[model samples]
Target: MPQIFFLSRPWDDRDVTWKFRRRPAPAEPDTLGGHVRVDSRTKNLTKRLSAGDVAVIDHEDIDRVSAEALVACQPAAVLNAAKSTSGRYPNMGPGILLDAGIPLIDDLGSQIMDLHEGDVVRVDESGAVHRGNDLIAEGEWQTDELNSAKMEEARSGISVQLSAFAHNTMSYLEREQDLILNSVGIPSVRTDFDDRQVLIVVRGYHYKDDLQSLRSYIRDYRPVLVGVDGGADAILELGMRPDVIVGDMDSVSDEALNSGAEVIVHAYRDGSAPGVKRVEELGVPYIVFPMTGTSEDAAMILADSKGAKLIVAVGTHSSLIEFLDKGREGMASTFLTRLKVGGRLIDAKGASQLYQSRISSWQLVALVLAGVLAMAAALTTTEVGQTALGLAQAWFLDIGNWFTNLFR
Candidate 1:
């Protein structure tokens, strides 16, 4: 029988004087036992991951967002067939995993992909991987020192990446000139935006903070809410329903899809929409908007084309580093799209900071009641107010006596 080890707290307690003890060494290798879960796309992999799972992925230079998602699942270990950091751009994914005390095995090669899901696998102290008594693969353990060296090397190549990014941007601009020059290919949807404020939410850096800050604005203006991909879930999380959900459909959950919001599946310029399949399976009605740019760009353009008076963005990328962190190769469509939208576009942070909270009806009523009480108290305490009150009481008594005499 194979010995099973559960690493509920793999590095919690350490023996300080284990070397001082004289004992026979165990013959078996130190190992972890778990079911194998594999996916080439890190994003898709995270959705299926559970605790104690051995995540087998083929992500090269995994980005921060993907790493964060994986870490949230609390896996037993991460086995990667590709280099976690390819020295491309000081990617933060590998460093984040290692810092979280999760074991990262790198460069296990393509053969690991052959392993089926739920197959029992064990990784030994020597970084060798085994599948049911058969030695399948071996990889280098990612240590802090090795990760640091790769990050430094990646940092050195930032300039080259920037140049390539610029080239890609120019190419995209030339290809999608119509989007910048004029309003074209705006898809029709049920949600109306004519002469209304539109709030387009994207799941990006600091999105939650920005959204929270805009609570007053959202309550006041009641803007037409548009969620791009996972942003629909964000909107739902805040107890607001999205008027329209636009995305490729991979990241958005089924609950958001079934949220009774008008769904628009983003497609390539060639009219292939991958998200429609899931929507169809859910028995929900949806339409396709085939475009080349991102779902965010598509959403903004749609709002503008529908005669929106103002467009506010929450959690949208505004800086170059943000774009790089999202692993976007080019922002040409985004830049041009903003230019087309022009004066209508507003960042949520700026709007939230500028907006002043308005007093509610209950607060106004309380203020009025407090004012009346203060006036009554002042009248009772002041000499002049007391005299005036006594005279008013005398006048009332005299009127009552006159009425009684007339009746008699």
Candidate 2:
């Protein structure tokens, strides 16, 4: 049987589609070549693949995870859904697979009629390839060096860019997050922070209700809002502004920087810097912490040092898959960082356990007003008024149905 894996989300767009789905039963056919679906954003999707797993990567998701996943899969071959190797859109998957001894099969998703597992097939890398023992020629051999070179060039561009981002930006943060978490000794700071506690927002992991659950707590506890790198953006999404934004400054958007948050630029040990310039250009106050780890780690450390009684973390990674996505060893750094956190380092996952229900009384008042307006419009004789009523009714009905379905 060909084992097939399906990627749940695209690589570049991790922010919107990072939610975990309940595992579903596999329906794909078993082939001699195993089919694996890897998320474009999954850091180690390709790196963790075993031999014989054919990785199906989205042609659009040209990032390190996709490249690494393709390498890790070590598949019999790769199938490009996009087909064309040239265009504005990126196709990093095909090139990586080809370089790693995997055959590049373009448009296999549309061309193949049917295929099964364990089928004896001869790949004609010398010319056009054939699937199974049938020796059927599905495509022509490429003679153009330029077209092939385009593939290599595309792959190289993506690899270099992602490697730089990961090494300089992401990896730095990961290391820093570890250092603070692992650093032993609970030293209290003399700084009088405005808040009683602090909220840390991480980009990935289970944070669906993290912000929502903490809404009341933010008001009651008066926690200093802190965002780690892109976690700053996540903080804004929750209708909260961060007091401090920590990271190497690659993934964060300009809107995040302009949100009146103080920036803390994570610098290298030897005094080399990138984020300092950006923060200065934005006229944001920033302090450089030259460390070997992630900004999240630094945030925790800063919070502890600054006299925070409790540190609440939201959307933080706490699983094997997540750690592997980082392409790191065990969470030794995270373990150590936690030791340095005195008082409480509460994981947001635990906070999600409790729930409080409340009625939106304002919604009822709005509905009644809307009904009166609709009734008033129904009595109008003008064509424009009738059209407006019809549109309003349709919109209300659609919204009502949507809400009703949610309950059902």
Candidate 3:
């Protein structure tokens, strides 16, 4: 048989090498005992993933957000048909899985996609996958040492990533300058953010803990709560109703759409709202905001234009790594959006560190009572107090005598 040839680039240098990963999956190892939940789309697959289930996906350079979603599902292992990290920009998804103690079998190729849903398969120590006595598919099982080495290597590409990031910012600014500088495509909302603190929640890193930390803030300020896509479900999870739900409406639940929250469909720049039909079918009245950015950016712009005094963001991206974690060039819009909404917005991801415990009503009442008793004690010890007490006692005794005489 003739050897196969394919061009591949090494992470360190800009050189191509003849390498092939599509060769009939390295003869599947002899093994048999695992169940896999398969989906080519990582996002969709995650929704169906449950504890102890091995997740099979085809995500290349899996980002941090996707990693977190997978970890949240508590999968037993992960099988990827593509490179978990292509050395593009030090993607952390694979590292996150390794940290979570999940076995990540990487670069198994497209043949792995053939495994039907709910099929019983077994993965061996050599990273080979088998079904009954038949060899199915196989790949490299990433270890902490290997993942770290790759991460260290990818760090060298940061300068390139930053340069590209800068270009993206200018590109977005050029296209959406009108939307950013002027209130161009923003729609009017009845939720009324005017003079009120607005809380925008996104389903992102540490969102649960961040939301819990805001219990006091939310109760005290009662800010208009805005949820972006899956974030509406997060709002509902807290037994709180969202004031407005925004996004393409794909990740958000039907219940959130019907929860009396004003629904707004985030449409593409061309005015195509994929979520519009779902809203119509649910009999929920909706407004479409045609924009060129992510739902997160749109929500902040809407709140700012609507006159929100302060915007406390929950589970939103504030760091460079997280902005890059979505693995989309559009994230450049987020950087610009942040600059536009400056001073008005604060990220609550760091809420744990910033959160101050509020004094309870019971404590305040006890303090007041103690103060009153201390004052009474001080009064009794003073000469002027004794005189006042004597007069008050005489007046009370006289009143009591008069009442007794009248009753008799």
Better of 1 and 2 by TM-score: 1
Question: TM-score: which candidate is best?
Answer: 3
Superposition error at 233 for model 2 (Å): 1.4
lDDT of 2 by residue, 382-404 (tens): 78778887898999999999999
Q: Give the TM-score of candidate 3.
A: 0.78
lDDT of 3 by residue, 1-408 (tens): 111122132222121111212222123223325578999888789999987777889999997668868877877678899999888777778866665556788999898889888888788877888877787777997876788888888887878888998899999999989999997989977788898999999988667778988988999989999999989988999889999999989889999999999999999999999999999999999999988879999999999988899999987876666666677888889998999999999888756646456998899999999999988887799998888889999999999999999999
* lDDT accuracy of residue 355 in candidate 1: 49
TM, every model = 0.73, 0.46, 0.78
lDDT of each: 0.79, 0.56, 0.81
Question: Clashes per prediction?
Answer: 0, 31, 0
Clash count (model 1, backbone only): 0
Evaluation by TM-score, superior candidate among 1 and 3: 3
In model 1, the runs with Cα more than 4 Å from the true position are 1-31, 208-213, 328-332, 348-408
Per-residue alpha-carbon lDDT of candidate 1 for residues 35-145, written as tens digits (9 for 90 to 100): 989999888888899988899999888766677677778788889999888876777678667656567889999998899999989898777889988998998877768
